[model samples]
Target: MSRQTSQKIAFALLTAAAVVVVVPIVLVIIYITIQGIGAINWEFLTAMPRNGMREGGILPAIVGTVVLTFGTAIVSIPLAIGAAIYLAEYARDTWLTRLIRLAIINLAGIPSVVYGLFGLGFFVLFLHLGTSLIAGSLTLGLMTLPIVISTAEEAIISVPQSFRVVSISLGGTRWQTIRHQVLPQALPGILTGIILGLERAAGETAPILFTVAAFYLPRLPRSPFDQSMALPYHLYVISTQVPGMSTEVQYGTALVLLALVLSMNVVAAILRSRFRRKRRW
Candidate 1:
């Protein structure tokens, strides 16, 4: 075959693969939106569930999911960024560091249900946090840490080595150099990772299932130590556990969860674009 023909064939194959990957996601979103749009009125969004979750709104679940997502971000972002900085910039090529990296990789590979079990055992039982928002947030945070750390570390490492060298040569301390030069450039990627991690944490059912999800709570949680309903678990219960749940309600809950994750992604994209524009190298 001619080189030109081979290149065209390869390009066409790649395009087809891309379309295959994207089409389903687009279809799913469209289907959910269509199914759920009828159920997304003000009363449905603002009121509490009634009639065994077949009527009314999902305010408590919405609030709980938002609060848990925020809590997860609070718990994970600082720790993940610090660990990433250490691993990417300060840590030497030692066995301990290697082991840490390996652990992170393994953590990322572990199933979500395992994290839920750990949360139930460690956070809920051992730490005496009980089945509450804090416990679930911690569980989700732990589950999300590996992703954020891996992405942030790569972002930090991607900063040009010459930038660090120049900062040091200009009489800047190590910490100062990183604070002023390295972090600014890496901020976009770090923010992207943090948002992505939070997005997953927001959507996950398993981590919250054991730690925090209330089977039928209708009120907003008063504190982090209180059991609350989250969208994922709420949707799961209505879809499977309830004998005669409304299809509209189930799809509406899924739509809300999807919207929440997509909103985080949009924010990440915006932040990444703005910061990349500001970056000098």
Candidate 2:
């Protein structure tokens, strides 16, 4: 076959694959919105659940999800950024660094259910956190660390070598060069990774299941030590565990969860775009 024909065939195959991936996502969103839109109103948004999740709103679940996401960010971002900086800037191309990178890659591929079990054993049992928001947040932080570190390292490395050299030659310390010159340029990519990590942490069910989720908590948690009602766990409960659960309620829960994740992504996208537009080098 001619090169031109092969190129056309490749383009067609790629287009078909994109459609296959995207069509299902669009259809699922449409179906969920149609089923759940009725259940989303002032009362549904504000009020607490009643009659064992057959009535009332998902207020506690929403609050719990937000708190959990915040906690995970607090636990994850600084450590991940520090690790990324060390890997990208300070670490030499040695066996130790390579080993560390390999470990991070392996960590990223571990199943979510295994993270749940690890949380159960270490956070809950060993630390005596005992199925609370803090434990769950820690678990999620660990799960997301590899993503943040890898993205941030790549972002930092992408900054031009001349920028660092100029900064250092102009009497700036190594730390100063990284903080002022390297970090700013890398900020957009770092934010992208953080957004992706938070999205995953927010929507996860298994990791939180063993660490923080309460099956039917109607009241909002007052402290990190308290077990909270999260959206993913609540969806799992009502959709399967609760007998005769209202279909509207289940669909509404799913819609709200999707909305929460998508909203975070949208905000991150806007921020990243603004940063890119304003970026000086």
Scanning candidate 1 in windows of ten residues, the lowest lDDT window is 272-281
Model 1 pairs whose backbones collide: none
Off by over 4 Å in 2: 1-5
In terms of lDDT, model 2 sits at: 0.94
List candidate 1 segments past 4 Å from native: none
TM-scores, in order shown? 0.98, 0.95
- As a whole number from 0 to 100, the lDDT of residue 96 in candidate 2 is 99
lDDT of 2 at 94: 97
The candidate that achieves the highest TM-score relative to the unseen native structure: 1
Error of 2 at 170 (Å): 1.8
Q: Relative to the unseen true structure, what is the C-alpha lDDT of residue 266 in candidate 1, on a scale of 0 to 100?
A: 87
